[model samples]
Target: MNYRKLALTLAVLALPGVANAHVGLHTDGAMAGVSHPFSGLDHILAMVAVGFWASTLGGRARWIVPAAFVSVMALGGLMGIYGVPLPMVETGIALTVAVLGLLVAFEVKVPTAAAAVIVGICALFHGHAHGSELPEMAHAGGYVAGFMAATIVLHLIGIGLASLRFGKAGLIVGRLAGAAVALAGAVLIAG
Candidate 1:
């Protein structure tokens, strides 16, 4: 879907988002909302995997799982914005990457209620990382809104990617992404 254009657009759009620079966007784009998912490899991979697996499952889960993650992640962002302290923010983010990656790779199936809780918890960690990393000039609310919006878009992109007719090739690539994410998580934990 015009990935080259998208990448170029993001580079231009991401310049002012200096705060997101910690994860490697040149500027602090505290206001990009759901699109924030692509700013960092860790966030992008895990969030995409979430969407991919959700799509794979189909049914109510197709939407319910990602919805749960976004809802709880909003709450977590609120907590962080309001100055609530969460220990090991980085570690939590790393663990989420690893866990979700594995979940996608293995096609782990859990009851809906349990699945919701798992997604919610992971979302909190993700949101908090976004909130805490905001640049100094950006308002907390605006910044959080921006990253949140960016995040949702990333999920949608993942869904789109999964919908492709790559057959076994697609599955193989998905598994590789998961393995890479898990490996990154391990390194994050070790650090």
Candidate 2:
């Protein structure tokens, strides 16, 4: 695969997404949805880690893991939108980051089905967070689309990076990044 093209595509896609400079500024649901994933460090780290881990697993996992996450996360989002209570969402999100990060760092191997289940579970917390945060005026459909698109973009980025074969040094760098992500998760848990 052309890593440069993938990287370039990701960079271009990211250019339009502004950070949460003024949270309520986006009156449009699509904008809000797209921007929400980028709003938090926890979300960004966890989502990227999911992609990275999936890539490390390789073969069918690269797609299946992320696909499971998005699917299950949508269910969680619906639950959140309808006022379904989920205990300790914040903690779950943080924990996923640490878990996914560790998975990447250690280059852990598990069956494809198992990886999907793990990422899918983690996605619930993330989806719920997104759903609960929906603005009253924003259309649910648009918001969901936006967030899902943003998420796919993030995953593609992680996949792209992991796909790059930099020999030993590249592998080391990626693993180090996973470690950093894990450390960040730890801090998030503490904070």
Candidate 3:
């Protein structure tokens, strides 16, 4: 991978105005929703961490964990849309990154169902955040689809990274990435 090109691409995608540029503002709902996840470093990191942790589990968890996250996330989105209040959503999201990154860094092993539950709880906060940001004028269905697609894509990217082979180097790199994510979460909390 061309590190420079990747960095530039991510930088461009994460511009401040991107997340607030909702479909109700100017663009179509789906596109707006799709871009929203990439706009926030917090969302992006936590999502990718989900995939990293899943891949680390190395079994049926590879699929079940992400599936559970997506499924429960939808329910959380509905709760947000319906005006259900979840306290400390931002705190929850940041803590999710820290916890998930620790799981990846340490190669923690837990039952698949337990892992699913952990990720599912985190996904609820994420989904609710997305839903709360939804524009009234936007097509709700399209917006939901867009964010969900973007989220899955991010997860896949993390999974792909975890699947690569650099011999023993891969483990080191993975742990380093996890540490970076955790540090980012700490910064988010502090800032």
What's the residue-level lDDT of 127 in candidate 2? 98
lDDT of each: 0.72, 0.86, 0.80
lDDT string, candidate 1, 9-50, tens digits = 654453345444366442334544445566788888778777
Candidate 2: residue pairs that collide: none
Structural similarity to truth (TM-score) of each candidate: 0.77, 0.87, 0.84
**Top-lDDT candidate index:** 2
Evaluation by lDDT, superior candidate among 2 and 3: 2
Instruction: Give one digit per residue, the lDDT tens place, for model 2 in 83-170.
Output: 8999999999989899989999999999999999999999999999999999898888777777877887888878877988489999
Off by over 4 Å in 2: 1-28
Model 1 segments more than 4 A misplaced: 1-36
For candidate 2, the lDDT comes to 0.86
Total clashes for model 2: 0
Candidate 3 vs. true structure, TM-score = 0.84
* Worst-scoring 10-residue span by lDDT in model 3: 14-23
When 1 and 3 are scored with lDDT, the better candidate is 3
